[model samples]
Target: MRVIVDHPGWTPASEPRRTVRTENSAWTATAGATLILNRVGEGRDQAPAVDTYSPMDLGGSIPENLRSALEEQGPVQRLRTADLWEALATAIIRQVIRADQARLMYHRFCDAHGAPLPEAGPSAFPRPETVLALDEDDFAGLGMAFKRRPLIAAAGAFIESGTKWAELPADVLVEEVQAVPRIGPWTAGATLADVTGDFSLYPYGDMAVRKWAAHASPDIDWPTDEGTFARWWRSFAATPEQLSALTVLTLALGGPRGQDQPPS
Candidate 1:
């Protein structure tokens, strides 16, 4: 059996296992077994919470075509990022780029500025302080000059009220994160969804979502504009939970790994 970890910054480690590190913990996951989490250095113990949701949860709410596609893709788990900074940073990096491009940039940014976890073979995202301390040359060198302002602004905002933001509900969190200068609706929505496991907070009109939805059900006429498509997407689900499930399942159907294999 093979298991793949879909979380950003995670990397494969030997057969059937993957590993990642955060500020407080180092984590290892083996196929068909519980996640093994250990303290990174030492400062209280922390572990990531894995939230699993099934496509079946949406039931009759989804269209026959979408439902069929999801069932074929199978169930997916939402592993919330242990660090809010990491989530925010990821969203900032992903803005206005293809998934493959964003992924390469993310890995590059981490390797350049983040602390290395040698044993695990992946680096942890740089802290807010580290981001603030960086000069323009540093960002430009990493090919992240475009993201410099947003990253710095987010770091400052996170330093001031990350704890409070973390406590806010998914909807509120999305709204709150937008206060930073360059952190717009789409970025905030993506960040909130990543940390909270509430895909209802995702920017439903995102190109990826729209693209995959159209790909999944070629017969359905999905809207082209962001606003109209967002409303059209909402009309399918009677409840927020259903909306989350529908959007997530649709994304999973044509995720980065491709259309056939769902994220585990």
Candidate 2:
């Protein structure tokens, strides 16, 4: 898939619709801001009805100065989550399944049951119970682990418990998702970015973060902790605009995306 950060764009190897790349951002266990980009209404005869939230201002938004700086560039168009639960699920599937088959299954699920919204209406996110209605083999057929069931089940619990979709604070979201079986930093941040627009959720802990960091400073002795790596990012991102620019810079110049993610 192609990610156009700003002026320069990178054609990420894996299809984002199916497989999500943790390295696409800057941190492995980012602040739970996983930006989900969809083709808008241009894909699979189905369109999502959810609003696209920016990663910079999820649940507990960023500081005003930082948020303004990030917003200076206008907006980064992303997918509507409510319309494509299968695609979102596909991101997890990508982690579990083989590369060649992820996109294929993505299409299969959408083609078979995806429901498009009205021209001006909101999109759809499948209910956890509805998703769990599927047999275990259904998820396994996608070449991923059986965690899909639990993941969906958890979403149901979250909804049933009256969890506000937009009220999860960054720290709370991180703690909540971390305890899940397949959720690591990357997955958690990715989810946050997509749903809440938490811009600070960098790295999302993908391989690209390490690669870009290495490329940026081949001479420095690498530090192993998240704290050390983030220090490097703060250097380039003193301002929010710099952080936005850094997302573009890291992708094209191989610099660090934030704390853990590298350039793709």
Q: Of the candidates shown, which would achieve the greatest TM-score relative to the real structure?
A: 1
CA lDDT scores, all candidates in order:
0.71, 0.40
How well does candidate 1 score on lDDT at residue 264?
12
Q: Which parts of model 2 are misplaced by more than 4 Å? A: 1-91, 94-105, 116-127, 161-163, 179-181, 216-227, 239-245, 252-264
lDDT of 2 at 89: 53
The deviation in Å at residue 146 for candidate 2 is 3.4
The candidate 1 region of ten consecutive residues with least summed lDDT is: 255-264
Q: Over the stretch 9-89, how does candidate 1's per-residue lDDT look in tens digits?
A: 544334233344455576654434334444455555456666565666674656678778878776666456767888888
Task: Report the lDDT tens digits of candidate 2 across residue range 128-189.
Answer: 55565666676677543455654575555454542443356755765576565555565555
